[model samples]
Target: MIRGEAYVPEEANDVWLSVIGKSLAYLCLKQAEQADPDRMSGVLAKVKFLMGLGLSQDDAAAAAGSTAQSVRVMKIRKRSSSGKKKKKRRTS
Candidate 1:
């Protein structure tokens, strides 16, 4: 549905859809990692993004080799953080 050819039901559409979804998710995560190598959390963000795009949370987690429970936990932790900055110490 995202600027690609639509598959017909008789042609194993679900299989093709799942494949495309996983590939797109992987590409997104890879690009994010390239921008921030220290952040493994990018994968979880990718999963959530895919879910927002209509893929089931279970399918997204499966594509990432994780569980829905883990995804929810990560999301909760991410949101619970306060966007406050720590004071920087100056050294001569």
Candidate 2:
């Protein structure tokens, strides 16, 4: 399960938040279906956008409202998932 923080904006307006939040949530859900952290760039971008707007990481994640840990885990996973290919040396 994903774990992270979330925050709702105050002056962002209620109606606008609802609409955008739902959209982000939908995108996150779709990414989950794919089960690929690499594919979560969109969600991560949104989270970054929120953070850029002065929202804390936790609050920005919460605002996105779907995949929380992606903001955090996506980094780790992306790095760890890449590895050099190995070739077998046939034993004589």
Candidate 3:
């Protein structure tokens, strides 16, 4: 049963209707995002929230419409401050 009061027809009682007959869920989600100026698909919010809660960059990126590899590289770049450390020479 669709318990939520929101008009998320994707949760309809009939499976086939929701999957194909009634409406596409992606389009509905996009419409909802378009209606709100503050939300960019509302995905970034969730992604950031997840990351804040200890989720890895790869997982967070997937939810944020970003690639895992890209997130990894971004994290590396963000954390990197200086160039490679210099090695000390030992005196004999």
Candidate 4:
């Protein structure tokens, strides 16, 4: 069970929603200001795009933090799920 903030879609024409999203993005930017302020603008842009895409909360958060695991990571566990230990297959 993953836990994080919730993403709620606002009306397409909701002025306040747009404002608030932008505001929150701005706050995130400010929090990360020392790292690279210019990049914050890009973050803001991506956030807007994700919101437009209707991504779920977890997806958006991962995108925002750049913490989304790569496809390889997601599939790695499956590769080892066969349960045949490599050492057992080797004979001296």
Candidate 5:
């Protein structure tokens, strides 16, 4: 199989590729968690990565071993803490 201009072995079919992708993703999740000494940061990293993979909040939370509510709260907090410009009050 051809992968991004590089030739891959014929054994690397769709099924095998999918399995490899999933395995790699799971390994990444573990690595992300272990990379950080902080537990919360690790969980957040997992959730963020899983969500980036197109999983919904609930699914991402589940895959990340966290609660959906926690994911929602994290998203809310992230939005609130972001550097968004606030509307300036008009002088009377």
Candidate 6:
């Protein structure tokens, strides 16, 4: 059901196709950050969305024409930047 480097299966529906198509198109755009291969925030969001839909990190990255490492880095950066601290519990 999923597509990968060696596997190219047909999309099950138009919705999935549309989202993936848009993601790929965004990734291929020519931007000022030509030296950086990854498409950055918008593409990262798409990759995350795809991952939420059951695609593996590598597969989502490949679908967005990005590397899994970059996706992981983006996720880590996002998490760190969120500034959420764990609450301390009081011992009785």
Q: Candidates' TM-scores?
A: 0.48, 0.38, 0.34, 0.26, 0.48, 0.46
Give the range of the ten consecutive residues with the poorest summed lDDT in model 2.
1-10
TM-score-wise, the better of 2 and 4 is 2
Q: Write the per-residue lDDT of candidate 5 for residues 1-92, one digit (tens) a residue.
A: 45678775777777687666666667776786777647526566677787776666676687777899987888778777897766799999
Compared with the true structure, what per-residue lDDT tens digits does model 2 show for residues 1-92? 24675565676678787667656655655565478556445756657666665566776677666456666897567556777445789999
User: Which is the winner by TM-score between candidate 2 and candidate 6?
Assistant: 6
Residue-pair clashes per candidate = 0, 3, 0, 0, 0, 0
* Model 6 lDDT per residue over 5-86, tens place: 4554565566778677656544444342364445444667667656665677787787667899988998888887899765
Best by lDDT: 1
Would you list the clashing residue pairs of candidate 2?
A: 6-59, 6-62, 7-59
Clashes in model 4: which pairs? none
User: What's the CA error at residue 30 for candidate 1, in Å?
Assistant: 1.4
Residue-by-residue lDDT tens digits, candidate 4, 28-70: 5456665666654554344544555565444554556653354
- In candidate 5, which residue ranges exceed 4 Å CA deviation? 1-24, 35-40, 85-92
Q: After superposition, how far is residue 27 of candidate 4 from its true place, in Å?
A: 0.6
lDDT winner between 2 and 6, please give it: 6
lDDT of 3 by residue, 1-92 (tens): 46775564655646765345223433443465577647644554545554664555565566467887776666566556456555789999
lDDT of 4: 0.54
Pairs that collide, model 3: none
Q: What is the lDDT of residue 52 in candidate 3?
A: 62
Candidate number of the best TM-score: 1
Query: Per lDDT, what order, best first?
Result: 1, 5, 6, 2, 3, 4
Residue pairs in candidate 1 whose N, alpha carbon or C atoms collide under 3 angstroms: none
